[model samples]
Target: MDLQVLDFPGGKVAFTSKMQFISETSEKRVPCYRVLDDYGQQIEYDCSAQVNEELAVKMYTDMVTLQIMDAIFYEAQRQGRISFYLTSMGEEAINIASAAALTNDDIVLPQYREQGVLLWRGFTVQEFANQCFGNKVDYGKGRQMPIHYGSNKHNYFTVSSPIGTQLPQAVGAAYSLKMDKKSACVAAYFGDGGTSEGDFHAGLNFAAVMEAPVIFFCRNNGWAISTHTREQFRSDGIVVRGQAYGIRSIRVDGNDALAVYSAVREAREMAIKDQRPILIEALTYRVGHHSTSDDSTKYRSMDEIEYWKMSRNPVNRFRKWVERNMWWDDKREVELRNDIRNQVLRAIQTAEKCEKPPLSDLFRDVYDTLPSNLHEQESQLRETIKSYPKDYPLDVPV
Candidate 1:
């Protein structure tokens, strides 16, 4: 059934101001949900038998790959090989588990941190390396900086740096799916800080009013840049915000892969079959610096990071779960690491040596018929590059 049209209790003018004040006041303390104990035991969320051995192993593999990739990229940044990097260190469960629960046809709109989802859904290691290195073979032709990756092949919408922009775009995509009568959904991922943006409100309102087939996936990773959740808003966390929009919502222990996967599975089914919008707020933490440029240690303690690392490590917990079911070996852990490490090394080598894209690339894709102004801009850019020394090559194709 569709949600009843939302109305202002005190009518438009009075309710508008009240709503703003209430939203502001409630921002300081948000309730968080957890289906898994700190020990990684599943608390009460339902996991269907369909979440069988094969799926568990695959999820584990994806999580491992994500962790390895993050670590490798961090090293690359540290070694001055790459300009920047972001770590999904503590939230591997949010990335892999959610992707694992989705169908191939579903669209994913990710915030920058959710690369693991794309990798899980068949994004290649080489492709990832290409984007990271801004190599000639990069899909974006070195225009986008490292980690700003996208792929139409896997139905992942290109990520936008402007926070909360994807929320409305996801709503639009979901509406389109509804119009096409497609049995698929769109999942929009964002951080808790993004919840405070106007785009987030607009997107949720549009989805609720139109009954768009979208899942609003918020990774409440405890901090948005240097701003803690307490500072971001006073509300009962991101999940409760969904209730005002009439969207069915839940909060899950984001470090727990099973809990995250199970919530996503149920949300996806509902969105696909019923053209409903769901909001899932994942309670997790950011275990590393915000990016290569930021020092989280200045804002948080070593003990806090260590606490999450040792007690709530998503990768380790999933490994334990797999062991619990006797589906995998702890020794395969070594083999898995070697295989992935080698793969990443090779991909980095290939990406590093590859040239950047051609100068013509800047002008090619914006429009079918380039405007005279853009044509002139392209020419100016080419000439500027040509003026530089041969060793400082700029016009060279990636």
Candidate 2:
């Protein structure tokens, strides 16, 4: 899985032979690996070995579920049910395919938009709703905002608000696993926008030097909020950065679910066997806005979004594959989608009806034993709430 290439213009450093400077973009760039064409037909190579009917159906269904979940939740935010929301639209393959490749033991450090990974690991739709609604049932205990989900049982780290913070954390976790002789590796996921952060470079360098088994998975969907990736950097993309850090790297077609699955599966093997870091830059698009807070039309054209949705959607592409293989039909599609929608609506209703976490949770979860300062603050808070009872909702247990 490791790609060997020259570091400089020449094979080795020469005193006077053909001096050259790095170009903004190179003609000879890293190639993107694709297993299927736009029609979901195999592109020369047979992908059945990498993705069979059973696995393909699961991946497709999971991706569809993710699509339905994101849409319904995004709408819920707009309708004032949730505070905020973000989506992995046009990047579903990057989520579920890569997730399917890894074992349950692999620790996940995710950026905000990798919900499909959580779904594949058995984090139920109700769990998603619980976290988004910030209900008492959420494992995070309503401490964080919507979608900042975590689960110790799933071995997935809770997502944070800060960009690129997970990169370093993933590296440290991988190093710990290495030193402890654990069989598992770490999958650190971030977006192209995160590459600009200093943490990205530091994490890659640390993992490379320490020979930690970690995979740096970048969903390069061409935008970080409002800034396009081209403006974010001038290099050929994220793959070349791995070369600079002495890490094995590959660029995969993020829309092609088979390619993503195979690339990540093999990458994991190489990372664990060699005890070295690997980088995968999954090229895709962001058809939806950055989040419920953003209107993508301000920066990108509606035509462009429509083109990707119609011509290059990962979900549609996978559905085509299943249809061609005789494993799917219109009836199944209709039933599956309608059921997912109903389940998501039910989840939202249940989550909304659940009580919010107790007011004491704000101070109780952070420490083993409550400090005197926190105790005093809690006391003051209780006293204030008691005096001004009407101002604070009584339903929120004091």
Candidate 3:
């Protein structure tokens, strides 16, 4: 079929009968963009240290701290101390390095695993324990599930469990920032499985058309729960979808801290200066189970998990890079790990001992003035607790 044309008041519209498609064969052959190798050595181009020695060491330190924190908290969940938890594990570089590239003022809307971002922004280990235990000190007042962390003080939005919802929210926030002439951009993180959602398409399209200053960081970590990437999509991963929406995109070696840091730094510049969205597909593997409830051995081979864990450990790779730069050593590594483990353990104990939120907290935040029905319910609950103090000893007075 040949081209067809139609004339309109503003301009002529042309259409072609030819169908352009990215077939599975072509997608399989698409090359992933990578800067650093498994050993943290440059692959092709030199990605020299843009940050000084202190910042470089700090990034590596945070990654190790995250690793240790995840291990301890994951054990806590298994030991029945916490209800649930998710670990950054193999993707620490993707979390901390990209975070290192952003300023404190930049807004971060993260998926659950990007807790390292908040940690880098100074969200303390104790706050993590508080949220996990859902104690009175938790910022959400024991309202949110464990691991769904947020901090307005750090400009990080609270994580929502419903996948892909944050994409549009990030774009909307970015649009508002653009209108307000703010100097910061928004960075939203989601998994590869999130790309399958309608919200992902809607968010990307809206951001592209509106030229919103947002970065869509997709952590293509091999598995979406039990479903592998091969079963998830037939295209050349999530990065290609960005191009389909006329947005600039790149795929980076997610395990390599330098690669992730460099790509995100450039992406932030493009997003803020150009007022456009950028998609980053970080090619990494999820070495741990999806969450505490998940048993990955049921779906994946232990051998494959061990391979990624031993060979592509992001923390080890970055540590090697920093050590090569003469800024880190085994003594510092030991001291940091010991300190983090002790801190996490102490925080967990403290959070558990803290009291639960008062019953009134539930009715307080929903409305300015309490509704009659809720008021009655609150009163009845209080009366019941007052009458049966033995049965409701933990319940606090309104």
Candidate 4:
């Protein structure tokens, strides 16, 4: 194959062109775009509710419910009722509003913390408890970890534990949707930390080149498990990377529900109509510990967390907006908090009482037909259980 030299208006490139060159234009900082201010109030421009009153109320209600659910579940993990857990503490708006902006048919590839997306799509509190508890009713049949949730009916993919694997998977799924001539698009959610992974680059490049209808939603919550965004990347956050890959992108106030909703709504439309990828970098903070395994205070200050909690809480900001609109009241707020608390407690109790997945489930779902090796292993396990029935009560065949 012959290598051809290409000439352009400002520059010429050839196989022998030196890779090292300084471009002052590329070094400029890109401004973060936002539609709403810290108070959930529209800033320079107005973006009215894209949804009607009923849907608007529902979105607000879900955000409050999600906050309550996170409180209870985090407590459950501390009490050792569940093995582990992750909460969408400060990113509720980014989760719920973004979900509200998409149709039910759109696919969601979530990182572990975006449980609000699943909940907004009608995943019941009981179902969440079931999965976290790894009970018989869990859709994963107790196979996945506590926060790894998925629903085919809801068009949400099962979350993988690997950090950046979902980015490529979302691109592939969007490509399939394009090939099928479907109107839907795929949304993949990841944190700022995921940008450090190789898959993020490959996925974005492929999506842009192939014109896959997908949204790469990066929740830049300023921390990737205690490593702050400053140390994560030297670029102007994740948004500039999208421009580098020739993908349209935006940055939004992640704490402002209205801003996030508006940004995602437009992104979805452009993605479906233009058959291209869009990147969203949601600027927010993580108010809670990264997970049950982490102690956030070890690295971050209580004063910093308190500042975000008091000044930029997404739930409180959205609540204030709803209150100003006369769509919510103090009495309703009290009622909602109490109602969600009771529901969460009830679901936790029910899930804890449910039986664990049967021992046979371990061998099932691996393949269409159980391999001879697995069958032999299953038989050996059963015999061992039979020999120590009391010690293996949960493994006893029903």
Can you write out model 1's per-residue Cα lDDT over 1-398, one digit (the tens) per residue? 22343345854332232334333545344545555565556566545625689898899988898899889989999999989889899999999999998987999999999998998999988999999988778888888879999999999988778999998889899999999999899999999999989999999999999999999999999888899998999777888888899999988889888888889989998887888899999988899889999999888899998998888788788787787778889688889988999998898888998888876777877889888999899888768666764645653662
Give the candidate order by descending TM-score.
2, 3, 4, 1
- Show where candidate 3 strays beyond 4 Å: 1-28, 44-49, 390-398
Candidate with more favorable, higher lDDT: 1 or 2: 2
Please give each candidate's TM-score.
Answer: 0.90, 0.95, 0.93, 0.93
What is the lDDT of every predicted structure here? 0.86, 0.92, 0.89, 0.89
Worst 10 residues of 4 by lDDT: 389-398
How accurate locally is residue 141 in candidate 2, as Cα lDDT from 0 to 100?
91
What tens-digit string does per-residue lDDT give for candidate 3 at 1-398? 32476666956788767888746555254466666577767567654437678888999889988999999999999999999999988999999999999999889998788999999999999999999988888899888889999899999999889999999999999999999998899999999999999989989999999999999999999999999998999888888787789999988889988888988999999899999999999989999899998999999999999999999888888887788789999998889999999999999999999988888887877889899999999999889878887887463434
**Candidates' RMSD to native:** 4.7, 4.0, 2.7, 3.4
What 10-residue stretch in candidate 2 is worst by lDDT? 1-10
Which of 1 and 3 is ahead in lDDT? 3
Tens digit of lDDT per residue, candidate 4, span 1-398? 34566677956667555677656346566666665566666567555546566777899999989999999999999999999999999999999999999999899999888999999999999999999999889999999889989999999999889998999889999999999989999999999999999999988999999999999999999989989988998888888888889999998889988888988998999999999999999989999889999999999999999998889898888887777778889999899999999999999999999998888888997999999999999999889777877876563243
Model 2 spans > 4 angstroms off: 1-18, 22-24, 46-49
Question: Model 4 — TM-score against the truth?
Answer: 0.93
Between prediction 2 and prediction 4, the one with superior lDDT is: 2
